[model samples]
Target: MKLEFHCWKCAKGTPGRRVTAPFNDSSVYRFECAQGHVYEIVLAQLRFEVLAETGMQALVDGYYRDAVASFAAALERVYQLYCEIVALSRDIDETVFKSTWKLVASQSERQLGMFIGLYMLENGDVPPQLPKKFVEFRNKVIHQGLFPAENDAVDFGQAVVNLVQPLLNSMMPRYTQEIEAFMIRHFENAEGAGRSDRNKHRVFFDFILQFDTEADDWDPAPADLSAELVARRSREIAD
Candidate 1:
């Protein structure tokens, strides 16, 4: 995955350096323009959102296997985020939480188990499980190296969207404070890492599946890959 941004120093009536950076685990991205101006941009979108966007792009480009892998990864990352938010609610120390996460970090099955347990405990309701068909599809694509067709890839992406959207809506209202706290910590870490008097810091938040709690009537588009692609491309043209 990659992100493109215009350089801050060269943004007048002239064209600015359009810097592109590969998306890694870190939210802070540093870029130096052709004119030697440096920038530190902290991406505010969570990891899951970025992964989902990458999956969508892959699907659009006909990389079906890569699409499935990225969508599956997005689901796992959201599970981790859910666990982290739950821990934050309980006033858990970040260090201890990181240590606990290490036990399951390398194993996605263990992470899923953690998320299920936490959701049940917090919500007092059974969390939604990935349908068996989707599970088999994911296992085939990820473990057995199956190259899915475009329709199958779209179905898998839709399944992920169906599962994640409700979870996001629920979490937004129930854990608003915790979510805000997490974002604050995220920006603080990014700023601290890239701290410099000479460098300008900027925060960017552009998630494909974002929810606006403040909006009175904001219905998300249906979980259709084709519709999503059209809408995304439309937005790109507008920008």
Candidate 2:
């Protein structure tokens, strides 16, 4: 099958050529661009990379990647990545932001699951839920050594049509919109928003002030906030 995808390096949308690589049923895709930036992807590695760079995941054949991380550890990693994505976007609908996000498109369950986790955490809306057969089919695509029946896989494709949106809504409340608005208001359109790299920290700082508990009910009247909290917030925004 053929699909259209963009290169991470050059931002050129190339028609992707997929070959069933070695490892037979493993289903690995080697995506290359004319400019020669190639991504050799399977299921798990793609998930880590997608979230690290784009706040999303790359799925292959209805498969997604996950690891059992302690809640605190996961929180630290995810939150840090979220802050970085926000800082890079600078309140703009930057190309990198759009190209990397996985809005649960077909054949990319990894992307969908990552979106689900975040959307759920943030109280976003989800579409319908896939039928149990489809869930099993998608799960088989992710975990090796789990061969689901071909009929189940086909059933999954059909049932997913209704459930995805509801599942998505169950997670985050207009998750994309709220974050996009944050980017536009402070980074893209804010006056005096300089383009210097150093000033980038200011954007994250502002983001933290907008969302973090440290800033909740902040008394701007008394010195605008305690000096210690200010220092802590500053350090967080920097790191």
Candidate 3:
């Protein structure tokens, strides 16, 4: 299916048409803007949003098992997105990032909770307890083959949404500018110097991050700025 994606170059929506190649079983797609910039769609990140939406719908339809599984998949994608942003921001070596991600990705849901706790501490954000609760509920459903209550699925789905919304709002514009600058620098370096294989590579929009003004208010409390509260929140997550 053709999907409408935002072109970072044009800052507008462009259609990404699907292309099927016989040589590869997986489907490929491309988006080209009027400015002659082309992009490849990253399917995995797109799938995360799809699954998240499906989970919410399934919860409403009373498909609790499917809802739990879909939410779990979406949560995993969230971690991947977080890692990618961190790596890019820190300018971590690609090889080292991959090696570290391998170990982090192999962790169980409980371990992910702890990792998130540390992550939030480092970022000076209070870690919400809902993510850990969702992970625990998902683990029960997956490992124990137990069904979650409809309310449990609903709560998990909402929690995941809550966790992702603000993150996307703060990161998307920064990353957009970063990628654009990187591309411009890359092309400038290659100009008149003879084109290399690197010049042929296109920048793809792996994920779409947007903010909703109508979504739940995420106002920070005055106490949130206090060092004592930050310490207390960190300790609360740890315990």
Candidate 4:
């Protein structure tokens, strides 16, 4: 997945020099257009959100296998995010937490176990589990090189949405402070890692699954899988 940004100067009704940038963990991105204009952006969405969006896009474009893989990866990333917030609440130093997490980072099953243990410890209940059938479907697509039909991909995507969106909504009230702290640290780390002396402009992006926790009415829109696919297809055609 990649992000596209219009050059700040070129976006003013001029022939826009759209810059395409690689998608990575860093929120801070610096891109130079063909005209030698540079644009730096601060993407506000978390990695999981972007992964979900990438899955949606892949589904829309009929890359069913890729869609399933991305959605599965997004689900694992959600677990990592939950564990990170819990660590913040426990006052675990970021460096120590990261180094410790690295031990299990390469293995998704270990990450899932870590998240389940931590969630049960804090909430006294196990986190929701993905359907066994869906897990098998994902494995078939990801490991067995299966090319699923569009409906199958949509079903997988919706399953992920059903699990992730509500999980995030529930966490907001319970971990508002930790979530905010995570966001602050998220941006700080991104900026710090991409630090440069050159003058740069910063822009925040609104992503497909991003929620505004600061709003009084914090209801998130329902991600109707079929409708979302149709709308995305329409937008692509219109573009």
Candidate 5:
């Protein structure tokens, strides 16, 4: 698969070329940009992290609707990721677990909450409630035609980012720590030059890496970005 990387030196997205490397008793793949900055590719959490950052950017750019949608998308990604984690932890078959998720997704009201409850039951981690709130807000905007305010969008986006950051850290410790260190170093350089845009990019780059980790064995359920949710919400609004 073609991967993208942010070159702190180039301050932009660069094409990453993949190469194999030996790790302990086995081999792993790594990516190198043209500038020779090599990084591990953690695809599992990368998708959700990218969605979360896109949502944050939309909020920063004053696109409230898109921000709400993106945050909702991020939250959904989190739910699916947690489900996959749960399944992996239990040694359950992917096909069975995915079929179960599909059935659960067909249900309305607190669907994500149910998955969160299952995860907490198994992992014993009391997840933050912000994701539940964000889901409600997303439903309101998409289904009730409610236009979320700027502050609400910003808060929700930040909350989702805060929640996912730690989860990614725990799931992929060494890789995340390395990425964090790299970003921190670059952040210092950007801060020294007083380039706010570069600093923002650094933050986004960190967010992107937050989702990339080594334990990416399972494929997450596909994200729901369709208009179907909005259409259903519209019908509810009319009634």
Candidate 6:
């Protein structure tokens, strides 16, 4: 089905049309602008495009793609949590929840990204190509609106979903174990998933380090952060 809408970035009239890409089978979408920049919107969510034309990809993403967003957000929170526990935990600061909660919420976004990325790797639809600088820009959004906007996120999200369909079916038994196997599949010349400790965390760490320089705060906690007191309190308030 052809989706009619304006280009999210250019505000020019464009439609979700398809053309063959060099590496993949499915026809990836070509979102064009009158000026020049074209967005290859792969996983075509008609609903999102409609809203995006109306200038609401951010809102739509928050609703539909909350998990991916929350993953990054959660890590940012854990960063603060770690810093706080390490330094400020001694002082009972009431304003501690500001950035911490936002970061915790980002955990879901990370999970969603992992889920989709792994899924794409399993299938042959798209390669496992994540843009590092793009994420770095999002981190900057904390200070200024200088980062690349939600369109890139939408494009990446779509590509991930598209690529995972095939792999999702074949790579069930060795899910995490197989991330390495397929890492080379997408990143042909690049390093595949390294089994060793320092190696495995590159992609994981790369995702987080884009915004903040700290490494993954993944500790063998007794419970998950989402399952801990913070989540419980949030739930209580919601209830």
lDDT of each: 0.81, 0.34, 0.53, 0.82, 0.54, 0.34
The best candidate in terms of TM-score = 4
Query: Which residue pairs show backbone clashes in model 4?
Result: none
Error of 3 at 128 (Å): 3.6
Over 4 Å off in model 5, which ranges? 1-45, 107-110, 131-136, 172-209, 214-239
The residue-by-residue lDDT of candidate 2 on 51-137, one tens digit each, is: 221111111122223211111122233333343344343554555555555233333454445545654554445523445654554
Q: For model 3, how does the per-residue alpha-carbon lDDT over 100-215 read when each residue is reduced to its tens digit?
A: 77776776564466447646854778644455566677779988998888667666666666666656555555565543443354345434243232233332332222222223
Itemize residue pairs with steric clashes in candidate 5.
143-233
Q: What is the lDDT of candidate 6?
A: 0.34
RMSD of each: 3.1, 20.1, 13.0, 2.3, 15.2, 21.9
- Candidates in order, TM-scores: namely 0.84, 0.24, 0.52, 0.88, 0.53, 0.21
Over all chains combined, what TM-score does candidate 4 have?
Answer: 0.88
- List ranges where model 6 is wrong by over 4 Å: 1-68, 71-129, 142-150, 159-170, 173-239
Provide the lDDT at 138 for model 3. 73
TM-score of 3: 0.52
Superior candidate under lDDT, 2 versus 5: 5
Q: What is candidate 5's lDDT per residue for 105-211, written digit by digit as tens? A: 76534557776687688668876556567768877888898888877876666666566556655555433444444334434543454323331322223332244
Better of 5 and 6 by TM-score: 5
Question: Mind sharing the TM-score for model 2?
Answer: 0.24
**Whole-structure CA lDDT of model 5:** 0.54
lDDT of 5 at 122: 64
Off by over 4 Å in 4: 8-12, 17-19, 32-37, 199-202, 215-217
